[model samples]
Target chain A: MSRPSTRPGLPRRGVLRLAAAAVALPAAAVLAGCVPADHAVTDPGPGPGGAAEGVEGRVTDARGRPVAGAFVEARGTGPRPNPVPEIAVFTDGDGRYRWFLPAGSYAITVTAEALGRRTLAVTVPHGRAVRLDFVLG
Target chain B: MKPFHAIAMASVLALWAAGAAASDRAVEAGVRGPVPGPSAGEAATAAGMPYAGSDAVSETELAASGVTLGTAPVGPLPAEMGGSEVILNWDSRMVLKTTLYPNRAVGLITRNGAHHCTGWLISRNTVATAGHCVHSGRGGTWYDRRTMRFYPGRDGASSPYGSCGVSRMHSVTGWTVNGNRDYDYGAMRLDCLVGNTVGWFGMYSHTAPLNEPAIITGYPGDKPQTQWISSDKVRQALTRQVRYRMDTVGGNSGSPVWSDRGEALATSGAWGYAIHTYGNAGAQYNGGTRIVSAVLNNYINWINRP
Candidate 1:
């Protein structure tokens, strides 16, 4: 909310008739707020080019035990200057998460509520899947 | 360059000032919500006598003065910081968006025929939104109140609590006149008692909640028929805004930025602190107009005014 470098946008010039999109997934189809069984615990597999680059890792608590349900996010430099978009996923029961992002630099922030605060910088090599783990207090 | 430039800014001030006078008199004449008719639609006409609402206003005034509906004060969606939205998952529950805090009343606000922004009900009939969402204070035109509609607790086509039209909209004169980003907050009077039905999030100001757990929920136009929620903490608390790195897209403008510290409030255990407006990509943070004393006082009077 720094002085918006830009002014408020105009209402659409004319009504741009847009087809309303309504795609209803199974209502509340989550268990204990963790991802579904398939996406959770199970590896979501990798994307196209083996060289496309990805990041996969496990989250653990102080004692080195898996920290399930931790909110993990990888924030990367985005196209625009104002809004920085990022890829966020929850660690599965095994406290593991894997997401393929265009090879680049990123800052990952983990919010586990009780674990205090932990932030780490990660990289998606030009076509390499990097493995990094977090040990939270 | 931004669409709202010097000339546009001046027009916003002049036109807004004129409308303010009419709005004041209209309110005194028992004109609760804006005149609701085809004439009061998005385009305000200069030549016309006003009608009354039920016997409510006619009982008070024989001939209501002509009230012109300004062209939509709120204009198009501003440039987005090029971001994507992420749905939340909690215990495999898909993080059902609306029920988590039904009374919080987070939903999409529609205006100017097709424009959309996010807002939340603060009173029985008053809603708080980004200043730009109610009127394009910076360089855009003011939206006709008749063209505004609020869908509280809206989940896709299903409006669990129902929808209502905007009656009167108000933004700080600083915003309307100076187009100051610091004053990027506004409120709208709804034509119906929707807040009483769906409940509203309580608003609090004058608190410095740096790093406080903050939650944002809104209907992102990117995901039509769906609402998204971001659970994060305040990264920076400024004089008039709070910054956070919450996943958001084009349609999240005017969203309520609230904290889960509602145990003290008799309503939903959430307190609204700001209205999400702008964000930065590399900076990785979104900024919202913090509900400071200035914003709070203006809104309290606007909502409580006759």
Candidate 2:
């Protein structure tokens, strides 16, 4: 989700100060990263009124064993990388990655550890989280 | 919290040129504003233009390519982002590519056949880089003192937008005089409007702990035919500097630390918040001068000059 713009914009000549401790706003979701053991997850939750949405899922081996540190890339079918993403991330020890994308269709690529790689397409709806799990062949 | 104080725009340039330290550090402007392009707000809208979202390729396709991918997420990136962190990927590799919009607008700047640094286009003809890129005030004070060359989107042997050569450059007094890393930002003016074709990034000024996902993109001298981009989270957001864990190399000195802030915040599709200047792999922290520094506003004014 996007950060709120300064209301009325910066006065023509006067500069507006960005709010300190702005992390208090809905955090941008961690697309993919490692979560240390015993550490609490401060996931940036959905934006106000669920105006936006996110996707979360796990990656596993064909044998169904969870995989971690696998590379996951989410590319929007747009003409350009754009405001959304042509972004790549890695799964965590729990074999999971989560993202709050501006509503759009996405082609996600997962590069499994030692098993090779695969790509999947999904259209995320507004105001919700979509779950899609994959088994690396 | 660093208190915000607006300085007189005109006096910023005068103070810098006349050797007055505006703050602990001072910046010099290159090309006066309002340049012939979108106002900062309009550019922010361009920066925030939305994407529809890319599709699936086969495992065989992945096997056939040789592109290196990143392994970490947007937290604190490894210090000294260059070296092993930047590996080449094949799918996104430059072949007979065409669009130069954002990538090509970023360029490889070289001097003395040895100094390789990165820079980004802010207007049709101006390039913004680290002040140390233009002049390393190392020891006492010493500029590159050599002719500089720029290759926009130069991949291996290919130059997508050809090369741009110009000498009109500017740097902040802190860097030019004392080599202070906090004030390490610079800008250059080209003779032609390369940005009119390539498009440029918009600028924004904000305070600490933005904690947003950020990407540091640049032409790394270590990689072959590749522009390395490491996506990570912004860390240690001080009033004067922004830090990230994205991987970068020596040549990436002036790379842009860009974030996809919204239209209300960033103005362009994704706005660059800082001018990447240093890397500290061991400490696991790399940083650059924040774009919001008053010195940069002076460059915005300089570039906008009629």
Best by DockQ: 1
The fraction of correct interface contacts reproduced by each prediction comes to 0.07, 0.01
Q: What interface RMSD, in Å and to 1 decimal, does model 1 have?
A: 23.5
**DockQ of the candidate models in sequence:** 0.04, 0.01
lDDT of 2 by residue, B173-266 (tens): 5554444566677777665545545467655554454687666767654444356666667767876777777655456678878754633221
The candidate 2 chain B region of ten consecutive residues with least summed lDDT is: B48-57
The A-chain TM-scores of all the candidates are: 0.54, 0.56
lDDT per residue as tens, model 1, B1-306: 433343344444445544433232211211122322223221122011111112122212212222212111111111111124333332111124353343226666875433267888666566778766655443334556776687765666655545677767777545544446677677787776544333455566636679887777775544544677776788888877788876565457777787645333222234577888764523557778887654655555555655
Q: lDDT tens digits, residues A19-67, model 1?
A: 1111111212222233211110101122222232457899999898998
Report the number of backbone clashes for model 2.
43
